[model samples]
Target: MITIWGRLNSHNVKKVAWAAIEMGIEHRRIDMGGAFGFTDDYLAMNPNRLIPTIEDDSVPGGFSLWESNAILRYLADAHAPHLRPEAPAERAQGDKWMDWQFTFAEAQRTAFQGIVRQGKDVNDPQVSASIAATIKLAERFDAALGQTPFLAGKAFGIADIPMGVYAYTFFTLPFERPSLPNMEDWYAGLTARPGYASQVMIPLS
Candidate 1:
């Protein structure tokens, strides 16, 4: 059996859960983080005190793992090997998009947190910064999509999961977002994926 910890609304949790759906990995979930209280047992599992820790009793090396991307990569490396890559060149392409999400997509949302999540107005300087950064990144996103139907190209893969989860916040979050056709098209395509709708496209907190 596999157990996943964290709120379904959490972006990080969505990554692992969505990946599991993509890979057809059966798992259960525990409500934790946010309004749900953390427990001593969870701490014992992941001292970093983060949501989205995973426990797969059947995996060879261990029962649990933390860090959502690592969990996604691990699952991809295991059951959905085609979703990831064994060769260096293909792996490098995947890494590029993952790195871009961490560096570009994640950073562009800082103001979004300071504004919307904290209940502050969009005009707040931090909010403005977030929008500005997002506008710039939206162009980048458009360019990326222009080249590939998916981030790592053609078919959906591990490289698409992390940022794909993050992308939801941008579109659903209450705020004005500049129009970028490429990003919107890419998101629409992701929305059509079986696992994405089931596991990733849920109501936000």
Candidate 2:
């Protein structure tokens, strides 16, 4: 069994937990970080002090891993081949979008932190600037989605997990956003998945 340590409300944690459920992996998630705080053992496992660390006892000597995207790749490569594209080139497509999510997140960080975490006014300069930057990045994502049904191509794969997590926040933010039909449609499909609904589609906190 895999032991995942992180609070459920964390986007990174949600990615790992949701992927585990989608892949039918037997694992248990323990709430840690945020208000729950972290233990010395947790810090030892992830020296960076980040949420969503995983320990897989199934590995030869017990393996602990960090980094949300890396963890997603490991889980897909090790346990769920279906989640990964078979061809190297095809797989790289998914890899690209996975990496892009960090950039996307960074672009929206100020707004998300201000509005979601601190409850700052949406019209605040920094918040509005961040939201504008996020919209520009999201437009690029929308264009990509317009060309392909999924980020990686025709089928939903690991590429969708990170962005799907963010999409909830993007769509739910209390501001006017230009409509992107492709992204909206893709997000709609994600909402229908039991794993996504249970894990990603939650009250933002």
Candidate 2 deviant stretches above 4 angstroms: none
**Count of clashing pairs, candidate 1:** 0
- Which ten contiguous residues of candidate 1 have the minimum total lDDT? 103-112
Candidate 2 displacement at residue 109 in angstroms: 1.2
All candidates: TM-score = 0.90, 0.97
Q: How does model 1 score by TM-score?
A: 0.90
Model 2 C-alpha lDDT per residue in residues 1-205, reported as the tens digit of each score: 9899999989899999999999999999999999999899899889887889999988999999999999999999899988889888878888999999999989888988899899999899999999999999999999999999998788988889999999888998888899999999999999999999998888888
Whole-model lDDT values for every prediction: 0.80, 0.91
lDDT of 1 by residue, 1-205 (tens): 6799998988888888888887888889998888987899999998887888989878677678898878888888777899986678767787788777776656656665776568777787877787778767867878878887777767778998888987887787667777778889889988998888987878755
